[model samples]
Target: MGQKVNPIGFRLGVNRDWRSRWYASPQEMPGFLHSDIEIRDYVKKKLLFAAVSKIVIERAWNSIRVTIFTARPGIVIGRKGAEIEKMTEEISKMAQGKQIKIDIQEIKTPELDAQLVAENVALQIERRIAYRRAMKK
Candidate 1:
């Protein structure tokens, strides 16, 4: 006889008695796992370039980093990192509780940052105009 068909298995993405088998079995060992948050934080820390930063965090552990990922981190970082320094002070107070860290990781491609910034600025301008029009009415 050919193999029997299982309707439930076909409908659901599982074999027959998959749940029961899973509950009945236990693995002897499992591989190490990592979460996205930890990885993101690690990347932020490693990728931050303070010299080119337009903003700098006095105490990285105490502030949230808002890195403007860009091909031209130099523009954002500004001369002597003054822009970043000012931004750090402005953001320092905003970091409440949890050790906050912000960083701007530069992308290899400049075009990407340009697109992102343009879209964001355009959105902001649109929102501002909408708000003003509403207020006028």
Candidate 2:
């Protein structure tokens, strides 16, 4: 029988890496995992317009570094960097007071990003554009 496999998981170690990098004790693993999940979701929902493509979480000692890959860095950074500052504070709370450092990376060629291309198509469709026209772009 045919089976479906996660493309990312299939490529892990071959050419891909884990989105999260951390070492946690058995008793604390679950909490850390859940916190990672919540932080990811919170960032995505907060900056939905930012076109986030990937989020990499790296933890060491008592600090967490959140690297966000997005097509729109300005939206994530906001005016005067206020948005990112607020975001960092919120994520710190999510990490239970651990330091949160947010690093936003802009996608140089968003046209090649599958997520960005798909989101563009969806937005065109939402605007009542024909499917064929949407795909053409």
Candidate 3:
């Protein structure tokens, strides 16, 4: 009875952008898509405590740029950025020798982000908090 659209998808290219900003050739599309998935999965698994909101990947001639948006930048950055360094090393291996650049962006308003809000709600529910009370704040 209602047409439901994802807020993020609806805003793409206007107020938001794609996670992977690359134009792949017809023959190369599958590989590129797979690589994107691998990179995203690696970040999610490695930085589970980071409260990551999004991972943006951009392709250059000889390098790939990965920008991670998270609610907890400190945790992702770690002490002196050692965690990021380690993640870079791991991602480099995944990249198959391509140069990789990693950037961490902090989310100032997690409450306004759909993904973050859902994650927060799920976390609260797991901790036995009431859904209404958790979402109220």
Top-TM-score structure, candidate number = 2
Instruction: Indicate the worst ten consecutive residues by lDDT in candidate 1.
Output: 28-37
lDDT of 2 by residue, 1-137 (tens): 98999999999989888999999999999998999999999998998888999999999999999999999999999999999999999998888899889999999999999989999899899999999989999
Q: Which candidate tops lDDT?
A: 2
Better of 1 and 3 by TM-score: 3
Model 3 ranges off by over 4 Å: 1-11
lDDT string, candidate 3, 33-79, tens digits: 99999999999999877789999999988799999999999999999
Model 1 segments more than 4 A misplaced? 1-63, 96-101, 112-137
- The estimated TM-scores of all candidates read 0.34, 0.92, 0.88
User: Which of candidates 2 and 3 reaches a greater TM-score?
Assistant: 2
lDDT of each: 0.43, 0.93, 0.91
The positional error of residue 117 in candidate 1, measured at the CA in angstroms, is 8.6
Ranking by lDDT: 2, 3, 1
Q: Give the Cα RMSD of candidate 2.
A: 1.4
Off by over 4 Å in 2: 2-4
